[model samples]
Target: MSLFVDSSSIRNFLRRDWERAESQLGSVLSDTMVKLGAVLNELANILDGDSAAKYLPLVGDLRKVKRFINAILLMQIEKTNLGRTDFDKRDLINLMLLHLNYPGLFRRIRNLFAVEPA
Candidate 1:
């Protein structure tokens, strides 16, 4: 018997995967916010000295980055849930790439969330 893959089945599989990814991305955003809050609390405890001076500006910059990330994540989640066939996927991919490639921003974020070595 000849075998053929149904087109609708492929579409359904892709849709499910996309939904799963969207959910995971939302979870990641939530986790990132929590981590940022923790970092903010730590920074707040250091009210003076060189560390505070250095971190104060970094935290400001990080806040701006966080806002940008929140917007991107919200846009992606909305687009994915809406299943807008006309939406250009490339735009979402480009935004993700831009965030990843943004000089020092990604590293700073990572450091904020990093677990210190014992």
Candidate 2:
């Protein structure tokens, strides 16, 4: 019947749309992972054989950026329902979210955003 055919066509279109969206999200996630890895590497460099105490401030800044990166990845993973496969259990954002979901956890994470790098 024509009605059945139309319904099938609609389903196919929706499936294609969903696939496209998923593909785009995967690309974004991949990009974010690369950026996060770079930031982590920089942090390692700062921690390695620090000759000056001033480097401590820079280390803190790199850490904050890392947190921001994790937050973004966590949000995307949650939206795409890909957290389990995309991120490990020790993921910073995952831990942060876990704490955030609890009551009165804002005091901890809120200060993180308030901090400004020198």
For every model shown, what is its TM-score relative to the native structure?
0.23, 0.26
Residue range 1-118, candidate 1, lDDT tens digits: 3123333332332334333544676665555444333332333344233454443333234334344345555544532432346644334433443454564775776678999989
RMSD values for the candidates in order, in angstroms, are 20.1, 18.7
Report the Cα lDDT for candidate 2: 0.43
Residue 30, candidate 1: C-alpha displacement in angstroms: 9.5
Per-residue alpha-carbon lDDT of candidate 2 for residues 1-118, written as tens digits (9 for 90 to 100):
3322232233343224333544576755565554444433433443444432433332234234334445555655334433446654335433543453443665666676796878
lDDT of each: 0.42, 0.43
Best by lDDT: 2
> Each candidate: how many clashes?
0, 0
Best candidate per TM-score, number? Answer: 2
